[model samples]
Target: MPQLQAAVKELQEKGIALPDYPDEPGTDAERDARARYDKVKGSAVNPVLREGNSDRRAPASVKNYARNHPQLMGAWTPESKTTVATMGAHDFRSRQKSVVLPADDVLTIKHVAADGTGTVLKDGLKVLQGEVVDGTFMSAAALEAFLAEQVARAKAEDVLFSVHLKATMMKVSDPIIFGHVVRAFFADVYTAYGEQLLAAGLDGTNGIAAVLAGLDGLEDGAAIKAAFDQALADGPRLAMVNSDKGITNLHVPSDVIVDASMPAMIRTSGHIVGTRR
Candidate 1:
């Protein structure tokens, strides 16, 4: 962002007519220019600003009270069906590459296709000495397969299916991933009416709530909604965010964050609320 501003200033000094960048634009053209500039604006402080992992412990008084009046927990048994699903291979964890920079330098991130086509994802990202840079990508095909398997396993085991993701933090990636989950779970619905959904401007990336809301505008909205209802009925029970209101874990990408959901699931004996089986 600083480099872009500097370049703009250099052009202005050469007598080139350019509108001054402002925090708030006063004109239509300036507003348009501001929109364009904002797209390129990003913070390098994201990594540095995040708090590091730390150990959290209960207060001494709380610990003493808990010990004095212990809360009963459900008994664990060999037959317990609790489990977590993950992309065991071809995921970000499996493919991560990292380096400790010995000297300060600028870098570019790019992607090269199997057919030899190249594209730059980011350019002129500057870094300092001793900084650790890591890069990784999850295989989309592997992810789809993993989600499909989990869906099937959920049905076979008669357990509620849910996918917990931290979409708020992983702003760019997790929404796309959540879309994949939506499509996987409703593979039949997508296969049948994918074109219609697209034409209606309903994207799964925004989650089922958005999709359902957009349906009201479609000519065949009722029919499409019926398909969704059938999908829920035929598939395994879904983990509900609110059973009474019919909000499932799949209702929104941001609702069930992994950190929040994981602890809640643990406290509930490996169960999240589910619709009647």
Candidate 2:
């Protein structure tokens, strides 16, 4: 704990502020702050401290692979193609409202100082705080409607239907979109195990593996498994991450990164591209 404190202090000296580590998290906000602190405690700080930034350029090997294994790059051609794209950049913001704080008022994280004062984490600040909207804005229903249209268009023109998502930096919201993709792809699995899933505190936003992982001792596990199998058999043609392991784009969060995935489609050719990058 002393080492962590010293490191955080050093970062603060360098103007690389880390979230305040709560001594005792009391309220819901404090508890959430503590949970976030726990996650970044050992893992996240070093990256920022050492590099001063999170975004890293691609490794040499990755560039080599892109050159050597061109087919892995997707069927990108420079001519005769049009595509529909979904950009997630700022689409998932819910209850969009702006708040302008007076200059005398400061915005601090939820943690309070020993004197019970909220320290000024940021001064002269402006914030537009909003909850991430689930379902209505971006959910399985949304993915289905999109895929239904794209799949129809792709089949009509005999082209590949592809999707783009960014589960990298957008972190929280993109994972939810990824979950929607999973539920849309495996509609039956979700329909069958939904109640059990919600009861187990699992949702499509966490991915289908989470739902399956929570099926510990359920009576309908086998039935859900069968339905999942059938959904795979009948679902629309999905972009594959790994054909050998059957890793579809929706199987993992970072598989279909928008920056990487969308360009690949545009280069190869395009049908209807959708993303919230």
Candidate 3:
């Protein structure tokens, strides 16, 4: 901890400010400095601290204390419309395949397209004996259809629409999924100006704030912005991460992680401590 603290202090002394969030604005030099510093931030220490075990559980002592002194609970009723939506088919869970390594070896993962073109996804991956390796894919068509249905369901049921993903942990896949969610939610806007938005270099994969950040550079930026606003107005009451700041759940990928959020929801009777719309 002291070493980490000293490293942070040294960075600060060099005029590199590390904020709680990654989106803080800075000069090009400061931003470059932050790019390096970010490698040490958040769960970067998990490999050292966790030592391969990431399945988190409270200790017996803490559990005993919690059982004795219970916290305030949120009310739940049979009439509650809260629901857990998931794609039981064509999702990662359904499509996962696993294999246990019988011997230590280096491997490569490749993809073959419909046209018989091959591409290397990963190479030189080392594995040990008895280590379990798994691979999974979620169908984009199925994901989009699922999201579209959920959005319409939320609107129909007059419920708050929100998505929780572990982008920080499931770094590659979750961000891509989050991007699909954003596109699905703002279907009309994307349908109308997707080509232009893509041309302007505003990728939805980085989150809505990123897309919004680059809007000023587009010739039709104002129109695109208005369309986003209109989508929000027309869509179901979206859950706000911070109603005070107009920060929706879709604004940032790291704000709501499943493990962190599920416990909070359980404590609050399925509530995420956020307002609707």
User: Each model's TM-score, in the order given?
Assistant: 0.77, 0.54, 0.80
Instruction: Write the residue-wise lDDT of candidate 1 on 231-273 in tens digits.
Output: 9999988988878888888899999999889877777677674
lDDT tens digits, residue span 166-188, model 2 = 66665766777666656656656
> Evaluated with TM-score, which candidate comes out highest?
3
Residue 175, candidate 2: Cα error in Å is 1.1
Candidate 3: give the clashing pairs. none
RMSD of each: 6.0, 10.9, 7.5
Candidate number that wins on TM-score, 2 or 3: 3
Ranking by lDDT: 3, 1, 2
- Residues 95-185, model 3: lDDT tens digits: 9999988987788999887799999999987676776888888888999999999999999998888898889877788989998999999
Candidate lDDT values, in order: 0.83, 0.59, 0.83
Q: Quote the positional error of residue 176 for candidate 3 in Å.
A: 0.9
